[model samples]
Target: MPVRILDSRDHVLRRKTIPMVKILWKNQDVESATWELESVMRKAYPHLLLPIERLIPFSGFCW
Candidate 1:
């Protein structure tokens, strides 16, 4: 199962969690990289993972 970066129990404050992994490119652009990452995740581990933004919706979501 793909790990959910957002809701995982961690050392940091709950509000500070950001599940999306940021990838940096040689061109210093990330717009496409983000999408690529999301795509690979969907194909490889669709059942175990979900986009963090889809769950949180707004800026603040509490558990």
Candidate 2:
């Protein structure tokens, strides 16, 4: 079955987590980099991985 980013576990993790990824602390521009990467990924596999801003309940994530 195809797994959606809105999976329950992903939802909880994203909501509770702040930095999201531990390595984010290592880079000041990690946030911007993340957006860049996500943008490329979404374009490449738009159906497989949706945008993070689209939460599960309200709007969701994948790792």
Candidate 3:
């Protein structure tokens, strides 16, 4: 999967309020991708204060 993301301000549909974040990518299995992301987040920010719902991943570029 080719995953990508952008700040809400950089998105073409940034005007939308519901999604303050924009994750763009080519994903075959969304469920697996979601779990992978969650795992990574949990490891990276073990003491994160923000709720899981508020966390957003933004990847402007990928190799």
User: Which consecutive 10 residues in model 3 have the weakest lDDT in total?
Assistant: 4-13
- Cα deviation in Å at residue 8, candidate 1? 14
Off by over 4 Å in 3: 9-19, 27-63
lDDT of 3 by residue, 1-63 (tens): 335333333223556433233333365444433222433433554443255456866556667
Best by lDDT: 1
Q: What is the TM-score of each candidate against the true structure?
A: 0.27, 0.24, 0.20
Cα displacement (Å) at residue 25, model 1 = 22
TM-score of 1: 0.27
Q: Tell me the alpha-carbon RMSD of every candidate.
A: 13.4, 13.4, 12.1
Q: Is candidate 2 or candidate 3 better by lDDT?
A: 3
Candidate 2 regions with alpha-carbon error over 4 angstroms:
1-36, 51-63
Instruction: Give lDDT per model, in order.
Output: 0.44, 0.36, 0.40
**TM-score of predicted model 3?**
0.20
